[model samples]
Target: MSRRKKRRKQEEEHMDESWLVPYADILTLLLALFIVLFAASSIDAQKFQQIASSFNNVLDGGSSIMEYQAPKQPELESLPIVEEEKKPLEEKSDKQKDKEELEELQRKINKYIKQNKLDDALQTKLTEEGLLVTLQDGALFDSASAKVRAEDAELAREISELLVLNPPRKIIISGHTDNVPINNHEFESNWHLSVMRSVNFMKILLENEKLNPSYFSARGLGEYEPIATNETVEGRAKNRRVEILILPHADLQP
Candidate 1:
């Protein structure tokens, strides 16, 4: 009877030791699961991907529940740019051609005056007002006379021919006289003399059918618009004159 009781106590001790092996195994599995959850929460995208790959390789034979995907970026819309166009080259070329033509006309008039030995009685200048042709009063009229000389009528005809060479532009004929007072049967004052002189000269220029009648006009400034002093005879002679102004086409007054 004593041997049987000792045998039963040894069997109970062996049963208690057998239960300890299964409990150790359950604790080890729970610890591994908690460590995996903690790493997934704190790790960056790259490290998480590496850990997922390691877990797959070690535990599930390369298959995994966790997946690593990169975030997508947003796209932007494009817009078109606009620019202004410049002036045409042909317009600039046309302006240059007009300037050259005006310069050539000036040269031709100067050459003609030089050849005829008319430099003393006639003067020419190219200015902002266009070509200016100045003729002394003595060359076209006698003392205190508004009548043009017979020989000087030829000068007016020649000038008209030259004007026909250019395009139609404003032609202004203005007459001026010295400050000396004058009262005669034919004229009352210097103003009357100046007006008659300018009108007569313009009439001769109009005899050419090629010249435009509408483009021509006349003015008489009298003694108030003298170019020189009335204190001397030479100065007074210079002040008494007729001026022909050829204005640019763009500068014509309405």
Candidate 2:
């Protein structure tokens, strides 16, 4: 009978928590009611954050996160610049126009040379340096004379007129000579002959009022600079010639 009573007491002590379960359910209901009330209050997140930032700024005496700031720009050195490449097409067009003008001038001179049947004595070439007009010595001079022939002076004038640009260009009239040294016709050496020949030819060219004398320069290359071999007759003849070179770029239009 005592064992039965002890067992009953133990079972009552370990009863399946029915009263505690109702208490737990009441606590949970209170929690849910508090959550519903809090949710109905409707707090604005952005305003709350801004107010928090303001309080932080006041407390710490630092800049506020809510303050306006201009966006940052890239550094000047980091930028990809093209100051030189601006107007690239314009620069190329200017150079091309200058080349075309030179070609046109060469064509005119070549036409003149062909019409006058002076092909053997005169030739025109347009090089990178500019327009080059080469004239044989025999076409403008006698055996040992430096003076240009009277008949050829007209030709020189015609060429001088053709050479006139809108704005004049620098023209170098260079005289070349064969290896044979001269001591006749008032020329003491090949140097004197070459110099005088270039000077006389340039003087005739400058007689045209359209041509500028200051733009013309006379140079003498006395057997020192030869285009052909000095050992052969044909080579010597080829070496004895005059050259007129119109220099580049000084008269370009902007």
Candidate 3:
């Protein structure tokens, strides 16, 4: 064989083997990736985290010798706190205001009663119905007659004036009689006498210009509602009376 032929034969026999090193390295990396994936599936959370962190460190930077600072995030102000709006307090009702005014009037009436010293004849009481101003039969009228006495007229006038209110209230003048049978000229029975007495008393009250006549009323309960027993003289006298009821509620007219 010639020398050139021998050289060509030797080159062909010893083909290029440098690619096997890189191929072997690629196979090793693939095997390592498969092993890591299998391990991740089976390993606990903590162990997996640790392994992942170690792998990242090895892949990114093998050593912690160099110090690097992350970009400082812009300083953020705390979110503004928003508060709720508060509501105003509630005002009093019309009924409540009326009640207060009525109470004040009662005090004034009580003071007048105390100063005048008419405890026996004129009596005042506060009740659920209204303020009741009770007058004895003798104080208001003479026996068997519905007319008020001349001397006591001044007292009746004063009471009528006192009844005059800014916002007028319902005024009911009621007359009552004892359990006595009567058949006379002026009065047919006790019922007639009581009715006339209430009407006469209301007429005197209506004389006050300041008071509203529409609010005034007159009624007679002849021997029906008696506070005391009518068997004795004193009890019968007590039973005969007149009541001036001042109602504060506008809804209750009578």
Candidate 4:
């Protein structure tokens, strides 16, 4: 055979049989697959939550986290702590409500006094301690006498009516006397007169069963705690009076 023909035959016989096309196709598919896998695995928890939420929207109406085992029921003793936690909140709410209620009550009393044209005879005040209703001695009693005057008895009845509706947290019926010392037959001293006055006034209030005697208390300042100086007759008249301090129950710190 000719050398050229022999070389041609050898070339044909030794031609490369590599499967490059199939191998390239497989490599490309594997690369694409790995890219898809990386994208799926690299998703953040936020994305996961969003996906779960979306899926839940389409199917069962709950998130994937809901499927996780719920926390075990707390121990029975721990339940008490739950109640304890709620107690202070409830107490605070009650205190706030009570304060508002007392304020409303004060407003009502003032309105009643103003409507009835008793503004001159009575004055309602909101003090740091509580509400105070100061009834001047001349308006409610005879001069230097423990007896509740006939005209003043009507005022007392009116006040008692209001108190019956909304009783004082503690009705401290304090009686005050002028600086002038008392040396009368019925009363030995101003102190005695002051105390007797308070006692007598409290007795009148307690006559109404609606007014709780347990909550009612009486005291005699006896020229002390004067609202005005005793330098003048008018000032002494102002000083000689009965003050009903409606202490708020919420403010009872003790």
Candidate 5:
């Protein structure tokens, strides 16, 4: 009986330990899976792709589960800079063209005034109102008369021809007079004289077929809007004048 019990104990000691090999293999595979997931979470896209390609090469025996690709940072960043650089240059170019046009018109009128020997009676200036051409009253009309002289009428036609070379804009013909009161046979007061003078001058300008009538206007300021004092003869003469204002184009308004 003792011999039989020893045999049974020997058999129990040798009980199968082969099942533990497969269990160890399963645990190792689980650890490898966890390591791959942790590595994927910590790496950038480039490094992750490289690691994936290497793993696929090693595990799949030359067959690949991942395709290598370059990062897309440069393409996304360069597109907007190219598109945003062109707008301000275009706007500046348009403004420059308009400025050049205004300067050219001023030069032409000044040249005309100098060549015709009318510089003493006519003056040209660039003002906020536009190109202002001022003419003394005695140059265009006789005392208390609204009729333009024959030579001055020819000058008006020349000016109108030059003006029509530009785009259509406002042309204001304004008349001013001295402070001396006048009630003559033809005019009731200074107001009537001023208004008639402006109308007649504008009429001569419109005789040029190239000038558009709709763009011209006339204003009579009488003795109220004087440029000089009324206390002296020279000042009074300076105050009696006519002004022609040529406005800038509509798109160039400040």
Candidate 6:
């Protein structure tokens, strides 16, 4: 009977171990919740990669977890944005009208040049930017002289009349020379020749007081701004000429 009682007591002791199992299960559940919370809190992809790499190193028993900041990408500043204002329609139409008028005037000048048989002595060209009137050296003046001939007076008068009848535009008179130097007693060099030529022609053009003197200027480019090469006589002859440039007025109808 005593042995049976002891066996029963041992069985009861074994049943008491079931309470320890519940406590162990509770601890396991708490540990699992803690792990989930830690995982949720540290969710950065770069941090995760570093932690995984660290864990791999630890598993191999190599090194401790290394904490390093991620390399930051450079931030580029935004470029300035500029919005252009559109021109008005009236301004555009006015520009077109000015261009048309300039073309018509160029045609009229060419007709005049042909009618007066001045094409041989002079050349007229309407360029992309302005009109160019070139007068040959012999046609305008004698060799090494800045004096305008009596025969050229008629041509000058015609040009002045045409300009006065038309819209006002600025005029630029320029003189050029060949590569050969001048040794005149009165003039020092080719620079003087070019400058005197421009000045004399300008003086004749401004003979009329009614003409706007402020609209004209004279410049001497010497042999530097030649239109042709100095290698051939013909080229040098072509370079020794005078140019009358008519520029569109900035504040005029254009």
Name the candidate that leads on TM-score: 5
Query: lDDT by residue for model 5 over 1-254, one digit each (tens)?
Result: 69999999888777765345565445544644554676665567766666566555645555333343332333344545554578667657876776677678889888998898888888888876688889899999999899999977987788778778566888899988998999978998888888889999999989988888999999999999888899999999988888898887766675
- Indicate the residue-level lDDT of 131 in model 1: 80
Per-model TM values vs. the true structure: 0.62, 0.65, 0.62, 0.63, 0.69, 0.61
Q: Which ten residues in a row have the lowest lDDT in candidate 2?
A: 65-74
Per-candidate local distance difference test: 0.79, 0.79, 0.78, 0.72, 0.79, 0.75
Give the distance in Å from residue 6's predicted Cα in candidate 4 to where it truly belongs.
15
| Candidate 4, superposed: residue stretches over 4 Å from native | 1-92, 165-168, 250-254
Candidate 5, pairs of clashing residues: none
| Tens digit of per-residue lDDT, candidate 6, span 85-191 | 34456567776776677677778888998898878778877775567888888788888888789888667766766566355778889998898988878788888
Global CA lDDT of candidate 6, please? 0.75
Better of 2 and 6 by TM-score: 2
Better of 1 and 5 by TM-score: 5
**Model 6 worst lDDT run, 10 consecutive residues:** 64-73
Model 6: CA > 4 A from native: 1-92, 252-254
Query: What's the CA RMSD of model 4 in angstroms?
Result: 10.4
Tens digits of lDDT, candidate 2, 158-215: 8888888986788999998998978874988998889989999999988888887888
What TM-score should be assigned to candidate 5? 0.69
Number of clashing pairs per prediction, in order: 0, 0, 0, 0, 0, 0
